[model samples]
Target: MSIGVSANRLELLQIARAVAAEKSIDETIVIEAIEEAIQKAARSRYGAENDIRAKIDPKTGELSLTRNMTVVEEVENESQELTLADAQKIDKTAEIGTVFSDELPPIEFGRVASQTAKQVITQKVREAERQRQFDEYKDRVGEIVNGIVKRVEYGNVIIDLGRAEGIIRRADGIPRENLQNNERVRAYIYDVREEVRGPQIFLSRAHPDFMAALFAQEVPEVYEGIIEIPSVARDPGSRAKIAVISNDGSIDPVGACVGMRGSRVQAVVSELAGEKIDIIPWSDDPATFIVNALQPAEVAKVVLDEEDQRIEVVVPDEQLSLAIGRRGQNVRLASQLTGWSIDILTEEEESERRQKEFAERTQLFIAALDVDEVIAQLLATEGFTDVEEIAYVDLGEIAVIEGFDEDTAEEIQARARDYLERLAAEQDAKRIELGVEDAVLEVEGVDLAMAVKFGENDVKTVDDLAGLVTDDLRGWFETKNGERVREPGILEEFNLSAEDAEMMIMRARVAAGWISEEDLPQPEVDETEAELDAEDAFDVSNMDLAELEAEAEALGLDLDEAAEAEKEAE
Candidate 1:
């Protein structure tokens, strides 16, 4: 007797096997789903109150329906439980908590029960299919997969990836690349996520790594680890740059990646829809790497600012356009590949900037130090960029300059100090006028000028400053104009380093009682301390005689004599 439709017990197993194979799921899971459907149908056929269960035999494809009743000392619900005496009639050894099964004939499902069973089986199969997809694709992320374009809805392509379906959002697709139904395409499996609806397999053609992976497949050296691709930047269907380094001393990474007569790179370019690929050698030095990244554009000079992770590249006036690319794409990609902000300048621009800086420094020295332009020009030519440098430099350094004596150096430093003091006083007056709170000024690097800027921006309190991140503070100081200018940031105007800004923010946090002393920045150890023997440096209080001797031996110092010398010096 069939429980649903016209199928028999053996046919149920046959259907489950076919579905499991088709869906790439386990046969046991399908069998359990069928059993649940059968149980639901059986309950509908009999009374709903009966404790019904359905089981299917694996080997023989046999189906069984039974009603389970528990044996207890006293039965309040007769349908579910039976007293010991009543159960003993069915089984002489029946005891408390023992379950008794009553076998029932196979069910003859009506049309409504058959429909309900179909729905149950369909729901279970869908859930199983979702689980199968999630399990199969979860580990396949970052792989390149080929699929047929199943359909497109609102510019989103749904790809049929053989065993699963993948989605490529419009933004993830290469620009100007149109996909038609049944068209075979390749994409990177960038993301695989499980959602309430189902497993989502996101594919991308514009990801930077997608191009890198394609090259890795096309180039044998890259695939075999002889050449490593450290970074990649792409503009999708336009241009792409990849930085490659060679492990073997003799192997040329760029030549190997380019293949015989550009075959390897052409393969990648074809895959990327005619996008231009520039294969450049990677360098440990960022300046050299950036120069290499801006190839075919002659670089006159490269000035690196390690503290800011920025590079100023000066190219010939004719090569400026080539260095910047169409709408700055070349420099932008170069910046991304080298992990630095790049500023492109022409030779003429650099020369003009130098002259302007020289004039400015000369004027500054003349005003601050009360010196003639000739003297100011001498100081500027010696690379005294600001008053603080002259004030803090070794006296010999300044006196060595032409026409400057030791007495002249002393007077210059004293004047620089006086000028700084007066500047600080003026800034303090302005800060007070702007109503900046004293607590903000208490932060180590939040001087009078910074405090005034903060007041202008409504960051008047210590808590306000503490709430800011380094980037927020940096952005706060950025000029409102779109034109890029040197020294545009307030931090730069005040000669404050990023570290200084971070320390100031941390100080504000500490002053607001938002953090403990343990969160404070550790004091940097002096170079002399770092040069000491490890035993003496790390554990001075617990040093043994043997360790002390070893330390003195390393330093070529006589322990007793050194102690006597130190005592006499003290």
Candidate 2:
């Protein structure tokens, strides 16, 4: 592969093939690099202003040099351009874009020229190698790769992944798990990014998916996709939980993952530096899945708050420590696995909470209805949570209560309505005292209670409410001291959904002149709503066939559904 003043240039193709094989790059790239080097050397040999080019015959391994000139109407440089008349003299069919090339004798590279060409070839080959590595590894993210631990630099583990290099940052490695140089290790390819130097591949041993990958390797059912791992939570070298479900009806997902006599799970545990693995069966019902997640501890009850995705789990008093685990690790992992905020309570604590809620409801009923303590207790026992429910409910519902006739129901409803009226009047006065403008109350969903809350929170005018975000009305959660804590909003007691809060804020914005009615965000048409046959819901009469097909596809409506709607329309 030498290129001295009188070296054999015929070995160009052989050199390209050898280099491409060594670097795992295409031979064509190597050949192009050599051609570029030859071009640079030829340019140096000829005058620098000449448009010199070099070409290599891929099959014959032959080299050729030529100087080219482009034919233009107006000649710019005497070296690189010529008038069309001159080009026409060389070739009769010459046009403006025609290029005329004159063959030049091969270059006899001087020592400096050889060195410069060598550097050019080396740089080109290196660039091609890097591009090859990037193309090969970019799509390998989320895959498990095996590599040798090449080195540990400043606490980061560098792995040689055969064709590419991957790094496991200090945080991505399992705790207390040390690796020696040249040791074989398996890791999860979490990310691959292109940098100035080369593609940077990020691998992780502590990622939850790493455990899932290990299980896939150990358990045939997982690899075959018969057993699906829905979620994974890892403490990294301490413990991990994986939720698995079986697509095959006869096979048990947990049993398959556990293997015969724990052999399968033990192999994965050995790989993870003895990390304990919990194989839980996944259920579509969140409560059932959460109960399965808290294994080895019996759950007395599970109450789910579907709107918030929070759960309250009541366990036996003796199983309290087991459910919580050391420093609350078990519950934390369970929350991560189930995507829910879990609050664990013992049966005794749950009983106390129930009694306290009952007492609070009873007290509210007595004061709102101006009833006796016995009547209040009866209303509370009948699940009457709010005075508004008693006021607005059908009289027959109240009369159906034990020992309660229609007359008693009427009296109770009248008192509840009176109490509500007085409360609204008081809230309105309080809002005025707090300097809230009457225009704020003009917005839809802004009742006297919400207006008073707005004033208490220093949002007195419509402009103030318009500037507030939905979180300021529906409340939000923040992480503090490594714990998620709820931050109360001004209208949190109203139990408004995020959509409802946003709508209220938008109405306020419209009323305050900050936004026009047309500027309010439009509701997206639901797929179901768009597929309805009712003309008021959706109209396909004006649409051409192609447009109707596109609309049907956009709504995700099947052909049968669209046909049925069309039939109904017809």
TM-score of each: 0.85, 0.85
Q: What is the C-alpha RMSD of each candidate to the true structure, in Å?
A: 5.6, 9.5
Candidate 1 residue-wise lDDT at 532: 57
lDDT of 1 by residue, 48-103 (tens): 77789988997768888899999988778788889999888988998899899989
Over the stretch 220-332, how does candidate 2's per-residue lDDT look in tens digits? 99999999999999999999999999999999998898889999999999999999988899999999999999987889999998867889999999999999988999999
The models' CA-based lDDT, in order, is 0.86, 0.90
Model 1 Cα shift for residue 120 (angstroms): 1.4
Clashes per candidate, residues 3 or more apart or on different chains: 0, 0
Q: Supply candidate 1's per-residue lDDT for 176.
A: 98
Question: What residue pairs clash in candidate 2, if any at all?
Answer: none
Clashing pairs in 1: none
How far off is residue 137 in model 1, in Å? 1.3
Tell me model 1's lDDT, rounded to 2 decimals: 0.86
